[model samples]
Target chain A: MMKELRTAIRAIIVFTIMLGLIYPLAVTVFAQIFFKSQANGSLIVNQDGKIAGSVLIGQSFSSPEYFHPRSSFAGTGYDAIQSSGSCLGPTNKKLVEAVAENLSKVLKENPGVKAKDVPVDAVTASASGLDPHISPEYAELQIPRVAKARSMDVSEVRALVDKYTDGRQIGFLGEPRVNVLLLNLELDRIKKVSNRR
Target chain B: MAGSMWFLLFIYLFTLLVLSIPLGLFMAKVFNREKTFLDFLLVPVENFCYRIFKIDARAEMRWTQYAFALLVFNLVGLVLLYLLQRIQQFLPFNPRHFGAVAPDLAFNTAVSFVTNTNWQAYSGESTMSYLVQMAGLAVQNFLSAATGIAVAIALVRGIVRKETKTIGNFWFDLTRSVLWILLPLSLLIAPLYIWQGVPQNIHAYTDVNTLEGAKQVIAQGPVASQEVIKELGTNGGGFFNANSSHPFENPTPLTNFIQILTIFLISAALCITFGKMSGDKRHGIVLLVSMILLFVTGFFFAYKFEKAGNPQFAALMQRGTVENMEGKEVRFGVLNSSLFAVVTTCTSCGAVNSMHDSFTPLGGLVPLFNIELGEVIFGGVGSGLYGILLYAILSVFIAGLMVGRTPEYLGKKIQSFEVKMVMLGVLISPACMLVLAAIGVVTAGGMAGISNPGPHGLTQVLYAFSSGAGNNGSAFAGLSANTLFYNILMGVDMLIGRFAMLIPVLAVAGSLAEKKKVPMSIGTFPTTGFLFVVLLIGVLLIVGALTFFPAISLGPILDHLQMLKGILY
Candidate 1:
């Protein structure tokens, strides 16, 4: 019995260090070498060299000049620190009210945009509150407002939406979504270039 | 359903069959204590590894000690994983520099991965850092899976041995399983994934101008390694929210075929290993056939249901499409999604290329029903095969009860103690699920988590408990599962559901290990034969149906009836 106990203790210590410590450290080193960008968080930055946000987490873009991501229940909107959706179902009254409020806000911000033009993602929260992209339709809806604000052509903005839209995997897997941060960054660049011109 | 092109499905199935056979054969040989082709190659490497570590490869352990070591090791892993999430901000590689995860959520995640469930209430790309993803979660992915395989191997050792206390050393089995079986297979497959366009990079997220002069941030990660075990171990938790649905993880038809094959490869191989260990290939064949029969049946129904589409949506939208394609990937089509869903559920691989909640009522129920059947249909790594073996024991017992003789499985007599342990393992989840669902429905606190109301809402609650208790981590995504109430309840449910079943399984292993091998007589039932295979299937269905029928009636079954009766409110 004593021998068995001693053996068990030794096994735990050795295996824990080897499997738990060394193996993970080795993998981490390998990952750092091979997948440096991904090993680092996939952070995106703006022109000023300030960190914008990760492509993974959704950011709030409430202005008419930027495309908006899905609705979020994260405290104060798109708070990555508090990553969570509204957790509201289709029939929940709070969900209905929240959707209505978001709709009104979108309509108020972009006057010419029709209510029907709003995408489902624009009003509905993603399962994870930190959805980084909006549907193509949602991106397109912000085009006119963004173009007018940035002094770019609406067609140009529309073309950008087309450019960023990722198609389904191997012709199909998921709905096409345009990353909001990426679009806004481009819009910022276009504005600067046009001003120089 | 457009992607359901018959040719594609055939190709996918054929690839899965071809790859799984060799992988399964190799895994079986590795785990069952036999010399494989890889054994010859891996021996020197194994010796070298042991030498560097200053360890002996020949250390053996009693079955009870083995079980205890595994449990204690994982218990520590659970605590460490939970603590790591809590203190991640202080940890390194956190460029976005996220803060600590909440207590309940952390606890839930810790239990989730440790139990081999890999159910994520939080998104991986955001909630975890590269450090945690690799050092913490991904490491757990390998170790947790190895743990399951070790447990299954221990149980098999128990059954195969006579008058022996030693099941095998936990460390040795775990190391061998990883070094020989999982790592080599993953190394071979990871490159294929990279070649197929799955990302394996450390390059920073690239910024490129869109055609419209818009900049887009492409989310990149160390995907190849994760993708390897994600399929190899049947640990389906994705690094991305979209899981294999994302192009980065699954780039092409070939990658998709590979992913499907990888999910079932280890699971199917374990069955062969069981047969090999028991000295009866037919015994393994019987179990394999039983699993295939159920899986194919479920697959067909999921296909048909999704293809049939929702009639209500069709009339309202004025679209003539006969498939419910909303929330489904157009590339995967209904057929592939249907197959993936069945394969994932059947094997306890929760990786979904499409939204399971968006599946039509019956289609959704198929996966849910698979979980309710206790995930034995080809469960997680080692757990699945052992779970099925438990069912095999039960089948034999029932046969014995009918024939007025002592029951035996793989030469070990299935006696009263074993039967009790098997019963406890089988029934524990249902008891937890049903009781919890009842508590949730009746209590104000429980009902508060419901975001959807009425019958469908009730079904969502039931689904949460079922998913939690069954250790199948896919959620309806229609419920608020992150709240304190859900976190605690589901956390506890997951803990009990996992360990409760596991303890009994281990106990049965210990008991069976002590039993002397019984010689087969003319009157003895041959479990490897077709008749016994059918009997095992019958036992699986009957036990599952009887135990879960009431709960099923209240949830998916009733919901199906409501949909059929046009009773949507």
Candidate 2:
């Protein structure tokens, strides 16, 4: 029995070191060398060289000049650390009221936008509160308002929207969405370039 | 929600079924101790490859030793994944030039995949780099699954052997599981997935023109390899946030079908393997039948409720096209969405071609109920079988008490020590869940996570607990769960919910290993019969329903009633 116990103990120690310590170290080293960008979080930045946010996490943008992501339950909005959605069911009165309130707010902010023109994503919160992108329709809805606000042609804003829209994997997986932070950053850049012109 | 989405979902399902069966069968043969067709055909090739790599395959271990090896392997994976997320900014392959994942999130993800749960607090496309996705997440997908298979094999060994001290070799099992099972199956399935439109390229994101003449940036990766294990292993974390709902992850209705089948294939096949290992194919079939019946029943409810859609939406829309699909993928339709929801939750596989949260109160309840049932309807790979076996032992114990005789499962006696271990394995998660939910509901901090007030809000909390405790990993996503409090709390739940049960299970394995295997007598109750199968299923249902009934009544059942009456309260 003692011999069996000793054998088991030895086995555990040797295997633990090899699997728990050595293997992981090797994989980490491999990841570091082969896939650097992805080994790191896919963060994006602004022209001012400030670390804005990751291209993955949705950020709050209430201004008309920027495209708004899906409604967020994060503290304030789009808090990455506090990622979550409002756990409201479709039939809940609170959700209905909240959606109504949000719609009113969107209408109030973006004057002359038709009620029908408002995108569903603009009103509803995503499953992940940290969803970084909005529906293409939501992006499109903001085009006129953003173009007018930034004093750029609607075509240019539309072009930028087109630029950021990610297609489905292998041309058929997910719905097309525009990363808001990326679009906004590019918007900022285009504005600066036009200013120079 | 949309007919097109339903069409696409059907295609995806078809594809998954087509691919998973052969793959699952192949995996079973590889893991079997007895030589298989592959042993004869692939021995030379395997030897050649091993020789080329200077590999040694002589390592052996007892069942307990094997379990420890798996645990230790994952612990290392957790540390490495955590560290990689912390230091990725300094690493390579980052064309977008990303940085490390936040500490808490990294810890959560590492634990999630290592436990075979694949719950994501962070989105895949944005948070993970290509390297992290492949090495950290994808690698874990394979190893974690192999770990589950290894554990199941250990448990089986305990049942089959008579007074055996050792179960099997840890190193040998792990290697064989990966090399013979996961690899060849993946090799075949990956290409099939590619042919069916799942991506298999190393090229970066590309630019494409849309129907509306908009230029879209398409996210592409080496997806086929990930998809193979992702489904086969039942690790449901998608390459994209939409998960299987994303068209890329599940392109055609055939693929959707295949993906769904892939989720349950190994789990189902493992039952057959169990019977074969026990020298009773009937035993495996009986268990499989029980699981299938439970699964089909859950699917029925989900289908009915979803097809009914929301009565409120019917009243509002006049036409009532809502079909209870507020958060569903339009391509899958109500039927497939409902089916997928039940299957994924029942199996502890979170792959969803449709959003689970969008199902009607009753529709959503089916999946939620499956989780709360302890996911024994073929739960996570190794975890699922052992979980069911634990229940099987419990059922026999209860039966023994009723009949005034010592209980036996298969040929082994269920002693007091084994009973306690099984009970601990069963009760720990629910205890953690109820306590946390109670704290969350009462506290201001907890209430802050509630986005919707009233019964459905309560349901969301219950769902979170159910998902966490069961290790399902999918979420209502409606709850504010990414907070420091939730992160820390759920992370604790994930760990304890996982290892707490695992330790007890390993203890049971050890105890069973030492027990003498008894021969079947006329007085002995045959576990491999329809009667026993019904009894086992009944016990599972009774335990789940009795334990969670009040909670369910407070959440989905009550919310459903209130919705019918249009009552806010």
Candidate 3:
């Protein structure tokens, strides 16, 4: 029994160092050497050389001039450090009410859009409240409002939305969606150019 | 379902079957002590480990010694992990400088990870530091999995070695499993995960200004390294609270597919290993087919219900036109999310690409049902193979009773003692789960953790205990399980669920190891035939369904009926 105890102790410590410390460090070193940008949170930069949010993580976009991301259940909304989901059951009244409230809000924000016209992703909360993409249908629903708010031709904003839209990987995986932050950033850049003109 | 969805499902299963074949053969070679492609590089390191630990490489043991060694090693691991969490604030690599975890949460987490449960009462990125994530949790992710593989190999040894008192050396099996198998696989996959946008650094959370200029703090960590093992080991604990749903943990659709595949890779391959070891490849193939059949059936049920979308939203929008999107990532869509949920739950790999709590009731029930089904559908690594084998024994015993002949499995007679041990092993989880869940549902402390009301609340309580008792780390997430009542109660439940079954399994192995192989006879049932597969699956389903039917009827079944009637809970 004593011999077994000693063996257990030595084995645990040795294995811990090898697996817990050395293995992860080795992987990190390899990642840092080969895929430096991705290994460091995939941060996207602004025109002013400021650190904007990651292209992968979604941010709250409430302004009428910008495209909005999905409704978030993270702390308040889009609290990146505290990632989470609204774990409300499908049949829960709270979820139904929350979806209804979001639907009305979406209808109010975009004039021509009706209840049926709104994409489900617009009103529904994402699993990671930090979901970066919104369905292309949701993005298009907001196009008229974004164009009206920015004092630009609807086609121009539509063109920008089209440019930022990401299709299914290999054309048949995942869903067709738009990155809200990137599209909004592009809108801001084009707005600046038009202002100068 | 769309034709495309059917195509995607076919591709996923086809890929899994194709990939697991070579891996299964390789694993057989690995444990058989035959030379493999990586042996030249890994053999020296393996020897060094044995030397440093002072393990006699040639020394083997009976089942009692193997079980004792495993228990002691796990107990030590549990204590070390608990202390690490308690003092993590004082530990290095804590760039976040988060304070020590609360006592109850720490205790729960320690037992959770050490048992390979990985059930998270507290969210990551907020509570755990980088060091604890790597040293405490991730180490267990490897060791606990290796422990599982060791026991499985021990069982396999017992089956194949005719009339032997000894099974195999626990130390040697543990070392070779980690060094030759888990490590090599992780090293290959970790880089792919990092390249796909999972962060692999120990930097502090970066404060970023959004385009709209709101302050946001992005959490960073050594995620890719842990992510590989988390799936590969079927550990399911995540670096972030959102688990695989967080874009950082599972970035692209390709990565999501890979993560699901990784969860089943070892468990599926072990079937092939079992076949090769049993000296009859057909024996293993029969079990694998039964597992796949169960898996495909569950996936179809889950996908159909999820694609139908939620009923309450029928008036708010077009129902058929829009699938259930609540608590699901847009990138994964409905199909991938449903597929992920089914795969994760069935394999006892609880990492979720979507929130299961918000799944349409019947869709949610599929995962809950899968876990309740003993997770034998290509279950967690080594645990899965051994679990299905237990059912196979039970099936033969029943067949023997039907006819007037002694039951035999792998050519060993199934006596009363063996049958008793099998019963104890099979009954432990459901008994632990249901009894604990009953107490949880009626008690104030457990009820307090429930996030939804009525049947849904019941589902939450049931899911937590089931996941724990099944050694499956996934959760409904809405359950506020960090409370003192839950942490202690579920902690005990998890230990019972793991060791109670494990000890009995080892005992069965020891008993079997002593018996001489029975020869084929006219009355001997062919275990490699289609009838045996049907019987094996039937026994598994009957045990699972009979035990769990009443409880699920009150939970998801009730919830589904209520939803169709436009009732809200």
Candidate 4:
């Protein structure tokens, strides 16, 4: 037992150093060297050279001038103090009422679009409450509203949405969606660049 | 949910099944100690490890010795991890400067990781430091998983070797499993996780302003490296409280699919490894099929219930379309969340892509029931294969009784010692889970953790106990289990749940190793056909249902009935 205990101790220390210290260090170094921007929270920079947000985290876009991300419950909408979901049971009255409230608000924003036409994700709270992307359908639904709000040609804004649309990975892994933060950022860049021209 | 969503579920499972076959073949080669493509990398590293640890690569041990070594090795890890957590305040890379964890929570975490049940009582981003996350948590992710696979290999050796007193060396199995299987696989998967948007850095948390004018501090750390193994190792504790639901941990749908697939990858392949070890691939196929049957059943139920949405909402608002987006990522929807919940629970990889606590009553039932079913539906990493084999033994023993002939499996005559051990292995977790859950409901400390009162609260306690004793780490999240009572009790629950079953399993290995291989005859029961799959599933369900029916009735089932009548709780 004593000898076995010694063996066990030695083996654990060796394995821990190999796995715990070495493995994570190796991966960290790889990420640091190769994927620096993404490794550090994928932080997105604004036109002013200031840290705006991440390419991953969703931000609220209440002014129709920008495309809206999904509704959030992360401490008053995308508060990252505690990343979480609403965790309301499907039948919970709170969830039902919240969705209804969101539905009306979205329809009011997109004038011609009715409640039924509103995308489910547009009205629903996401799991992390920090989802950065919205469905292509949802993005398209808001295109006219966003274009009108920005006083841009619908075709140009539509083209911007198409440009940022990430299709399914490997032809069929996840749903095709557009990154709202990135898309809106691109929209801003497009308008700015065009103005300079 | 649309038809396409249901179709997506099948497509994902089909893809996983197809990938598992080739992966399983590779695993078989690795386990048989045959030459592998990874030998170049493994040989030198493994040889060095064996020499450094003074573990003779060829030396084998009796089943008792093997179990002893496994327990002691794991004990060393538990102590080390606990020490790391206690002293983490003084460690480097703590950008958060998080202090030492409380004693009870720290104790719970140590046992949780060592037992291959990575149940987090506290939120990771809030509680643990980067040093602890990598050194303490990530290290156990590898060791605990290797420990599970080692025991499984030992059991395989015990069955394969006729008239042998010794199984393979614990040290050898542990070393090779990591050197060849785990490390190589993680190398491939971790990089891909980063490519798909999971952050992997030693950087501090980034403070960003949301458009709502609220300050949001995005937590950042060595996420991808820990993540690959968190799923790959079937250790479900997350770096963040939202678990896989968090965008940083599971950035996109592709990453989400990959994460769920990785959880089942090694576990599914282990079945094939078992078959190859026993010299008949059919035995493994049967077990895998039974597991698949249970998984699909659970998946269907969870999906259907979640998709049905809240009927009360339909009535109240007279809405046309109803899809349950509550507690689910709109990105994945009901189908993926349901599939993920079932897979995670069934395999004892308790990583939640969606909150199980928020599922419709019947939808939530499937995962809780999956854990109660002893997690043999593909089980956890190495533990899953061995766990189902325990059920297979029980099934064969029953078949022998039915036919009025002595029971035999893989040409080994069933004996009293083996049966008793199987019984011991089978009953321990359910007994521990139920008794503790019953006690938890009656106690103030335990009840204090229940966020929802009434039946839903009962389930919070029940799921915690089940998750603990079953060595599955997914919690209901409604249960605030960081209190002293829960920490102490569930910590105790994890230990007994893991070892009690493990000791019996090792004993069975010893007993079987001593028996001579009996010849197959006309009256022998065929274990690989359709009937065997049915019987295996039946035995698993019956045992689990019988043991947990009352507790489940008081929890999810009753909660479901209340939901039907628009009762919120």
Candidate 5:
């Protein structure tokens, strides 16, 4: 029994070093050298030398002039220090109240939009609380407001929304989505479009 | 939406079924140690490992000895991983300078991985260092899976060999499982994930400005390698807390498809290997077909309910805008999200692509049902086959009793001792789940994790224990389980769920190995073809439904009824 225990301990130590220490370090070093951009967190760089948001994590956008992403229940909003879902149960009254509160806010924000027309993704806190994309419907809902706010024609902003829209991954893997960060960035770039139908 | 969901489902199934054939055959060859192309390269490595471990490749072990070796090996791994986490602050490659994990959490995480249950009370990117994630968690991902496969191969040997005193050597099975199968598959797939945007660096997290001018932290790590094996081995421990749902870990539709497929690849192939080992490929094929049928049924139920939308949306209900799109990634949509949920839970892999907590009550119930059904619908790698085969044994025993003859499986008698062990194996998890769940609700610490006060609260605790007892690692996302109470209780559940049942399974193998093989006869109960398949499935449902029905009614069923009545929980 003692010998067996000793053997077990030795085997584990050896395997641990091989797999835990050696293998991961090798992969990490190789990736750092070869796949630099991705290995370093796929950070999206803006026009300036400064770093913009990741193409991955969703960010907080409060502008009616900009499109809304998934609701963040992260610390305040989109706080990456802690990542989690609202984890509200189906029957939880707080979840119901929170959704109701969010709905009223959406209604108050969009001057003429009704409560029922609001997309669920717009109101609910996403699992990661850092979901990067919003439903195409949510994006579409904000188009008129965004266009009106930006002094761009409704058609012009709609066209940009369409441009930013990404179909389901590989035709049918995920859902159709519009990256809100990229869309808002595009909205910023479009300083002067006319009423050219 | 429904049409697209169906289309995607068919494509996923088609790819899975077609590909499983070659992979299955390759695994069979690898197990048999037959002349294969990779043999030339891997042979010396395997021999070297055996020599270094002081194991005799030609030697065989009795079932007890095999179980003992496995326990010792896993215990060592458990200790090693535990120590690694405790001392991570002092370890090299800990870019975050994270301190040692609390002893209870360390204990929980250690048992979790060693048992092939990757349940996390703590978030990965924040709490764990890169060193712990790679060396500790990922290493156990490989070794634990190899151990499961080794036990399974030993059990298969017991089934196939006629009155032999021993099963195959544990070391041989472990070495072959890792070297010949898991290592190659993980290596081959890691590059694909990297291409699709999963990171593999040891760099510190990058802080970048958001479009709103708010600061955001993007975590970086050796993700691609860990990501592939986490799925391929059915380990399900994600480098990120959001698991496969996180865009960084699963970026494109291509990565999502690959990830979902990899979850079931080894498990499904092992079914084919089972058939080959039995000298009757049809037996394993029947098991696979049953698994698919159950899987497809659960998948559509989940999809239809999710696509049906929230009935509570009065105005939007008529406008066809009431769908439960909450917590689903629009990048993957409703169909892919539902499919990934069902697929992950159906195996021991619990990597969620969607937040199941936000699913429609019945839709959420499907994933829970899959786990509660013992995850045998193509369960985790080696664990799944052995689990379902236990049902196959019990079913044959049942079928024989109906015909008024002695029960037999693959010409081996299903004696009293074997039946007792099988019954114990089946009963143990449910007992743990129920008892612990009851304890969890009654206790303040467990109650602290509860988000809602009623049935939904019941489900959070139930989900925790089910994930525990099943060795599945996904959470309901609503449960705050990082506390010391859950760490200790669920840690015990994981150990019981894995090892307690495993010991009995090995006992069954031992008992069967000692019995003489009876030749095929007119009176023998069959486990192949349509009738036996139906019987095997019926046995599984009866066991699952009977054991779990009352507790399930209080949670999902009650929640579903309330939702239909326009009552929110």
Candidate 6:
């Protein structure tokens, strides 16, 4: 029994060092060497030399000139430190009221857009409040508002939205999505170039 | 559902089957001490581990010794993990410098991982330091899964070997499970995750100024390494609070698909391993098919309900997408989210890509039902095969009684002792789950943890105990389960759920190992084929439904009815 206990203790220490320390460190070193940007959080740097945000993580985009991501329940909205969902059940009053409010808000923000045109993603909270992508349909719904705000043609804004939209990975795996951050950033870049001219 | 949804499901299952057959055969080869492709490199490592463990690779043990070694190793692991969490502030790699965890939560977390139930009462990013996450929790992820696989392999030996006092060495099996199987798989997959943008760093969380000018702290860690094993080992603890739902952890649709496949891979392969080891691949396929059937049923129900969307939103939205998009990523949408929910629960892998608490009542009930059915639908690695095998034995026993002949399985007689052990193993988990859940609902302390009201609140309480006692770590998440009452009782629930079933399984292993083989005769019930699969599944459903039906009706079923009646809680 004593030998067994001794063996158990030694086993735990050895395995912990091997699996816990050595293995992960090895993987980290390999990742750092090969997949540098991805391993370092996939941060998107703006033209002004400032770290904007991650391409992989979503941030709030409530301005009229930018497309919006999903509704978030992260700290105040998109606080990566407290990534989480609004754990309200399907029958909860909070969820029902929130969705109704969001629908009305969407309709008010975009002129001539009906309730039927708004996608469900426009009114729902993502599992990770940090979800980076908006459904393509949600992105399309915001194009007219973004164009009106920027005084750009609807066709020009729509083309930019199309460029930012990503199809399902490998053509048929997940839902089609648009990276809101990238599209909004491009919108700013295009506005600056046009103003400079 | 779209035709695309059907195609995606087909691809997932086909990839799983194709990958698992080779893996299953390889595992059978490894455990049986046969040569394999990786042996030249891994054998030296295996020898090193055995030397440190002081295990005689040649020395076989009776079931008692095997159980003792496992218990002591796990006990040591439990103590070490608990201490790590308590003293994490003092440790290096604590870039956040988080303080020692509260006593009750620490104890709960320790037991949770040690039992292969990675139930997180506290969120990972805010609570655990890097060292603790790696050395403490991640280590257990590997070991606890190894422990489960070892027990299963031991049980397989019990069925295969005849008139022998010895099964196999626990330390040997444990070492091989980690070094030979879990480690290689994790190593291979970690790079994929890192390439797909799961962070693999020791740096502190990054503070970035967003385009909207608010500061966002992007949590970074040795995530790719841990994330791979988290799914591969069927240990679903997440490094980040939002788990796989966090974009950093599962960046793309391919990563999500890969994660699901990895979660089911080893557990599915083990069925094939059982067949190969027992000299009957057909029986393994039978078990695999039964599990697939159960999984498909649960997935169908969950997907249908989720796709139906929430009725509350049906009034406002007339077109465009109206699926239940709440608490689901746009990248995954309703289909992948629901599929992930069912997969995570059906197996003992409880890593959630979407929050179950926010699911449609019927959608949420599908996962709850899967867990209540013992998670034997491609269940936890070794645990799933042994679980289904126990049902196989019970089925034959029932068959024997019906025909007035002695029950035989794999050419061994099903005696009363075996039946008793089987009954104890099968029934103990649900008994603990239901009884403890009942206590939680009745008591004030338990009532305090509930976040939702009415029948939904009952579900939050029931889901916690069910997740605990089933050794499934997924949660309704809205349940404020960090309190003293939940921590202690659910800790007790997990321990009882894991061991009470485990010891009897070992006892059955011991008993079966000693029994001489009875030659198959005309009267001997065939343990393979359509009839046997039906019988095994029938026994599983009947036992599960009988035990959990009443409590379930009051919870999710009632919640669903209330939702239809426009009752909000």
TM-score, candidate 1, is 0.79
TM (chain A) per model: 0.86, 0.83, 0.94, 0.89, 0.90, 0.95
Query: Which clashing pairs does model 4 show?
Result: none
The CAPRI category of model 1 is: incorrect
Q: Write model 1 residue lDDT over A89-184, tens digit each, in one string.
A: 322345446656776777787788666555445554543445566767777777878788777888999988887777655554444667776777
lDDT scores of the candidates, listed in order: 0.71, 0.69, 0.90, 0.85, 0.83, 0.90
User: By the lDDT metric, which is better: model 1 or model 4?
Assistant: 4
lDDT minimum window of 10 residues, candidate 2 chain B: B207-216
Chain A of candidate 3 gets a TM-score of 0.94
In lDDT terms, how accurate is model 5?
0.83
Q: Write the per-residue lDDT of candidate 4 for residues B1-569, one digit (tens) a residue.
A: 36666567677778877988888888778767888888886799888887788878788799989889888898999999999999999999899989999999999999999998989998888889988999899889998999888888778777888998988888988888898888888988888888777888887888876543456788899999899999999999888888999988998778888988899988898888888878899988999888887888888888888888767545533565466666677567677788889989998789998888788889899999999999998999888988998999999999999888999989999889999999999998899999999999998888898876668888889999999999999988867889999999999999999999888888888889989999999998998799999888888889988988988898888888887777764
lDDT of 2 by residue, B2-121 (tens): 554455455554554454445545555666655676787667755554454333545545656666665666677677678877777786555445678888888888888877887777
**What docking class should model 4 receive?**
acceptable
Task: List runs of model 2 lying over 4 Å from the truth.
Answer: A1-88, A94-197, B1-29, B40-60, B202-217, B319-322
Across B361-469, the per-residue lDDT of candidate 5 in tens digits comes to 8888998888998899999888899999899999998987888888999889998999999998888998998899999999999999887667777887898899999
Window of ten residues with lowest summed lDDT in model 4 chain B: B312-321
Worst 10 residues of 1 chain B by lDDT: B207-216
Docking class of 5: medium
Model 6 agreement with the true structure over A1-197: per-residue lDDT tens digits = 99999999999999999999999999999999999999999988888988888899888977777788889998899988888999998778999999999999899988888888888889989999999898888888888888888899999999998998888889888889999888888888788434321
Candidate 3 structure quality by residue, lDDT tens digits, B1-569 = 48878788788888888999999999999998998999889889988888888889779899999999999999999999999999999999999898999998999999999888889999899999999999989999999999999988899888888888999899988988899889999999999999889999989899998766678999999999999999999889998999999999998988998999999999999999999999999988998999889988999899888888887786777545457898999999999999999999888678999999999889999999898887889998788888888889999999999997899988999999999999998998999999999999888999999999989899999999999989898888899999999999989988998898889889989889999998888789999999999999889988998999999999999999998888886
What are the interface RMSDs of all the models? 6.9, 9.0, 2.1, 3.4, 3.7, 2.2
> How many clashing pairs in candidate 6?
0
Q: Please list the residue runs of candidate 1 whose C-alpha ends up more than 4 Å from where it truly belongs after superposition.
A: A1-197, B1-9, B32-59, B201-220, B251-253, B319-322, B564-569
Q: Evaluate residue B184 in candidate 5 and report its C-alpha lDDT on the 0 to 100 scale.
A: 85
Between candidates 2 and 3, the one scoring higher on lDDT is 3
In order, what DockQ does each candidate have? Answer: 0.11, 0.07, 0.70, 0.46, 0.49, 0.70
Scored against the true structure, residue A114 in model 6 reaches a CA lDDT of 88
lDDT of 2 by residue, A42-144 (tens): 4454555545554444566656667766677644655443433454676677665666667677777777876666655566555445566676876787788
| Cα displacement (Å) at residue B351, model 2 | 2.1
